[model samples]
Target chain A: MSTKTILCIEDDRFIGEMYIRSLKKAGYEIDWVVDGNDGLVAARNKSYDVILLDIMLPERHGTEILEALRGGKEDLIPKSYVIVLTNFQQDDQSRIAMEKYADAYLIKAEITPKKLISIIEKIQD
Target chain B: MEIKKGPQIASQFWPEFIKQKIVLIIVSQIIISIAVGCLIILSGFLAIGSIGFWLILGGFFVINLATELLIVISATRPTKDLLAAIINVSGEKSTLTPPNPNTKEYEKTGFRDALQKIYELSSVKDKQKTDESEKKDDNQELSIIEALNTTICGFITLDKNRQVIYANKPAPIHTNVDGIKIIDLLFNGNDTLDSWLDSCEEHSVHDEHVWTRIPDRLPNEEGRRFFDVIASYQKGSTAETVLTLIDRTKSYIVDEENLDFISFAAHELRGPITVIRGYLDVLGDELADVLVDDQSELFHRLVVSSNRLSGYIDNILNTSRYDRRHLKMNLAEDKISTIYDTISDDMKLRAGAQNRILNVDLPTKLPTVAADRASIGQVFGNLIDNAIKYSRDGGSVNVTAKQNGNFVDVSVTDNGIGMPESVVSQLFQKFYRSHRSRESVAGTGIGLYISKAIVESNGGTISVRSEDGKGSVFTVSLPIYSTVADKLLASNNSNVGLISEGNGWIKNHSMYRS
Candidate 1:
């Protein structure tokens, strides 16, 4: 089987590093982007099995990036599953991300890195 | 006032009423002329006969005076009827009519026509005067409304039918012209505006101002804008209002930012805590064979303390979420006993950790509740945790459940450091840690508040009963799934489910759908 790849777009450096460490340890190839703009560019460049996107980012919001990717004239990254990982747990943001075709909404502080990786593995299966 | 003035002028002004006087004068002159000529001719014949000539002259003079008086009296009678007709027309008592036809032909037709023309002119002048005053009043009212529109955040006036009669600058800024109903402009999409307004009408009280978040579709960019809506019904007036929205965006944004900061801070704190816990778990598992007895116990203590701190952080975040109305609930139909069973093991473990005995008694036939199972668990979990926290060493903390009428009443009774009546009343308030427990107990003081919010949002009530130096019983009463069905059956027992049929509540089938 081909190697499973994941993209983690998070602004928090430590959390992002922790996720990268845990997922790589779990034998999954992972790419991490710290800002929304770079994440958008990276998401368009290649397809991944899972893309963990954060709502709050440095340059642009994750919702806007998701909208640009999925709500465009052509589907920018149809093969990738977008999971919204955010510290902000507001209803409108959730609704917007879901409406823009996000596959899952998870609070970053609520779930552990191991559990997140296990979820990704389940999606792969 | 205008009608009275018209009649007053017609009565007091004598010259304007001369159409009748002119006719009387002409008829009296003709009668006098004919009488003088006849008398003169008759007296001349008497004088020629030379006997009783003086008596004949005297007789002619008396006959002439009598004819003149008769002519004057007849002319005055027609004039009085003409005056009565004029009074009637001016009083708006009847339509215009000519005087009784006792006078000459010119007096009948010509005098009546001239009089009618004069009356028409006067009536038109009165109408013009009234119109001018009304126009002035209208202009004054317009200026007042314009001033209000400029000074206030927004102003919208609806006519009795609730159609927009006037809307000011900020009105169009929020409520686009596409939204015709005033309710559309005022209500946030979280609730149905029509039903809310109908309730408002039914209550007949518009004294309260409701705070609503403006929908995102409107041109508010900074964040979600809020408006304070005040509605007043103007009975028998031009405007019957649904509501008026006053822009409260600035203060609302400040409040939102504060709440957001709390949520952000709580999440930031929890992130490191989770990582620490994650690493600790990995270490404990990896080194389980190598660690000694004391080290293992120390690690276990660390994990318990970390978990406790994590729970506190969660409480803070949940409190922030509840305050901002961002808490999402996934409601489902489940038996109350099932919820109790799910959390009873966890509650017992937590209580055992704190050196307390936790007892749970669940009735077998408890009805199902339409509630978010996880949220209800949290609510019950918080109450049990509080019971354990407050109880003395080895004290009994009883969690009991029973069916009470339409509700399932679950009570958490603790025999520990009981709070006073005053403290019990303030227990559920945000950030209200009790004075007695603050020194020894570690808590965020928001667990009870969050629990109350969760319970209430699930169509339940949470209340406490306590006495000074005695234990407290915190009871959560949730309305059962069949409660509405039972009420529906009782209110209209013969009709079954059709009572709320079109209103979307199917009696036995989906009354618990919400």
Candidate 2:
């Protein structure tokens, strides 16, 4: 049997609730954090399959959270891969995220709900 | 200065001679007749003469001469009364547009009342009416020509020889020229524009002709803050040159203020869009895959709203440039073909969404016109966008280019809802739109006016023609830059960061997919 935990961090309550309902429906145990500070602490304390990062977050900001996970700060337990969520276009961020070891960034509008499932499942594999 | 005692200029002395000739000729004839009568009487004395006979003959001659002089007096009366009658009649016949006639409404009260109103207007100088009042519901049009003579933007038209063919009242005050050589309005001896004038005259007879333009900062006085004087070919069956003076200083200041706001807003907005994209990537494809539920609908709504919001923001930013009316052209040597291709590609998405077709027929090899690249690009974009917006569903828009020696002509043709002759008449008016806009099209009515202003600023011209039901075509001509910009371009020849590089930080956006 395969078992994995996913940390979904988001600021928009509507999309945050969608993530909790959808990922759990897909049968992965999910840890949901609303703010950037909670997301930072949860990543450090828990072991998770993957980290779902929302670039726009209310607390502690998305980039600072990425830098912290990249070991910008002292320590974190789970060495989970990071997948970015963004609406802005331009290759620079994708290139830089890879330089810092981020797995991928999905352009927000370009992806549909069905497509979003495929990308998440592949990353889980 | 010696006053020459010889015959003066013909015009001046001809009147005096005419006056005196009638008096001199009449008086002399009377004397000569009187003398002849005396001679006849005295000579006849040898036959049947009495002293009374000579007196009666002389008196009869005097009376005849007196009658001739009185007839001449009536003939010599000036035509001033005739001119007064004509002015009074024409003023009564033709409608006095707006503010001029606003007071005339009192005339329906009675003839006595109308005369009283006329007396009132006569007492108040025309200057008392505010500019706002002049703009009353195109309800009426007063002779803007009459307004020009006094309020300041003097209107003047000159012929090929720099002769003052027409001058409105305020010409001397605005131009600071005291009825001197008409060419003096355009050039001074210190400025040698003989060669430049040659370039301008070539356009005079052609479909588009223009003179060398020297836009200098207008001497700043209180009301005369800054003015732009444009001399362009007013195309007609027989083409005439038209010069328009626009006071841009107030509009210029407003533009500067708007530009500042845009830069500030743009800078702040970019940071948030970058952060939003970062979160989207982290959520993975799972976020979009949820659309089967109501949650997905929310996602769709979010995307649509943001896209529309951003589009409006971009329009405001673009128009802000022309607002200040302060356009500093960074002139460069550029190929028209490449420029056309770039604009076509950039606007392809807008066309695709509307299912509109854009056909560009530019020559493989093109002559270069010296111009501001970004400004010209925006001009093309606005024109094409207008075409697409007004076009029938799935209609085609065509662009064609050709060079005639010193200028490049670009025409954009659209098989769209054509403009009626009435609307077409004011095609380039600010905030002017046809009745069709109220029905289907959307616009601010400022696009063409701004486009015309930009093309003219760069020593170019823009024109249009449209049939009521068929379609419309807009043609623009820009002078081909021969040398200066090309030389500068040769030295700074790197294509790296030549265009807008967007704001600084890119690594800040990583982990973005889709």
Candidate 3:
């Protein structure tokens, strides 16, 4: 079996670096982008097994990127599972909209590295 | 002297007798009859002829009869006319014939003129009284308007046509409200006021509605305004609808600005906490094999404290959201055990760090409850965290879940320092901290409040029973999924769960009182 690959789109430098270091140490190939625009570009260029998206990002919102990727009747990246991880709390309507498109929604402050790894493993299984 | 006194007394008596018209007439008749008798007797004594005596007596009798007729007419005619005039005036009929100027009947009797003057004076007096009463009513209305004007709240009275009948000073502060429609003056194409008025008219009852962030009509003014408006249908008042507007602009703006700042601060704080927690998790995992037991325990405590800090941030954010009525709940059928399983590991870590034993008891088969899983997890997390924080060293914290009829009850009991009845009574209030624990315990005092908010929003109830020097038990009961699923699903799209608007729960805290 090949190694699983993950793409993390987070704006904060410390949060982004923490995700990269932890997921790399957990034996997964991880690509980190600090802004929504580059993250979307990287996602379109090469498909990863899992995509971790953050809501509040520079250049564009994670929601806008999700819309561009999978807002149609069919998923743009059919195999990639999208998990929304963010500290930003969304209103009900926005949350309901995100829930429809994303595989899971997790609060960043509530998730530890081990927990995040276990959640990713579960999704992969 | 006696003769002189007799004449003086006779003069006084004659004038008095003359004043009495009926007596004078009767006396005159008697005198005339006496004169006739005297003449007859004298004629007889003088031995006059029988025919002459008879003739003189007949002539005296004729004069006597004529004088009696004159006396009867003079005595009764004026009285009859005066009585007829009185009846006419009392009956409100102007039927009394006007006195002829040529005949001068008014000048002759003077009674008709006197009655006319009395009638005129009385009618004038009645008119004056009515005018005075009307003036009093006007003054009363003016004073009421003046009183209404002194208040900071705006008041306006509208007729059935929605035209402004009366407006206080604050009501028309921005516009000239005379003859303007209420909708035009205060609202620009907003149907809420119109609908509220219509509802009041339909129900014939007083109804209240709130309008938030209403902009000023004046072009130069800045900032938004809030109003608590009431529309009432008064049965007998001159106006159709009485509108009372309490300007909540200042307090409302202050609350909004404060909430905004809180939200921003909480968001900023969340990022750093997330980073710290993530790095700590990474370090704990990487050093798991090399670290000794005590070192591992110390690391775990760090992780727990960081998690606690994150929880505090969430509480602050939730409290601010609750105050602004912006907290949204998406409820679904979820198992209580499933939610408990997600937070039990962290709960154990927290309890162990505090040197408290943690025990969780869940039935093998438990009913599903109507809940928002993530928020409900936060509630359990908050309760257990509180249990660990408040418990004495080496004490135990127990979490038990059971199936109550039509609901599931989860109780978190702690053998802690406990609290008095006074603190228990105010346990679920916002920003309330017991005096005993205020300095010793580190809390924002909104955990239970937000927990109550979350649980109640999911169609559940949360309560606590505590005794000083003993312990505390906080229980939350949620309805079974099957019972409330249909009702919740029907309104799920629009309903944002429990919302208490205004400063309602500040003093009363009635939401969780029972």
* CA-based DockQ, model 3: 0.32
Candidate 2 or 3, higher TM-score?
3
Model 1 ranges off by over 4 Å: A1-3, A24-27, A91-94, A121-125, B1-264, B325-328, B334-349, B359-367, B438-444, B467-470, B481-514
Model 1 lDDT per residue over B216-327, tens place:
2333234455666665664446766645677777756664566567677877786677577666655665689999877876776676566566666666766666655566
- What tens-digit string does per-residue lDDT give for candidate 3 at A1-125? 36889999998888888888888878899999989999999999888999999999999999999998999887788778888887877656576566556766777888877778877876665
Instruction: Assess every candidate by TM-score.
Output: 0.52, 0.39, 0.62
True-vs-predicted CA distance for residue B303, candidate 3, Å: 1.4
How close to the true structure is residue B421 of candidate 2, measured as C-alpha lDDT?
A: 83
Expressed as tens digits, the lDDT of each residue in B446-511 for candidate 3 is: 799889988887878898999788889999999999999899879885323222111100111132
Chain A TM-score of candidate 1 vs. true chain A: 0.91
Compared with the true structure, all predictions reach lDDT values of 0.67, 0.58, 0.74
Best by TM-score: 3
Residue B179, model 3: lDDT of 37
DockQ-sorted candidate list, best first: 3, 1, 2
Task: RMSD for all candidates, in order, please.
Answer: 11.8, 20.7, 12.3
List residue ranges in candidate 3 displaced over 4 A.
A72-75, B1-145, B148-259, B403-405, B493-514
Which scores higher on DockQ, 2 or 3?
A: 3
Residue B398 of model 1, lDDT score: 90
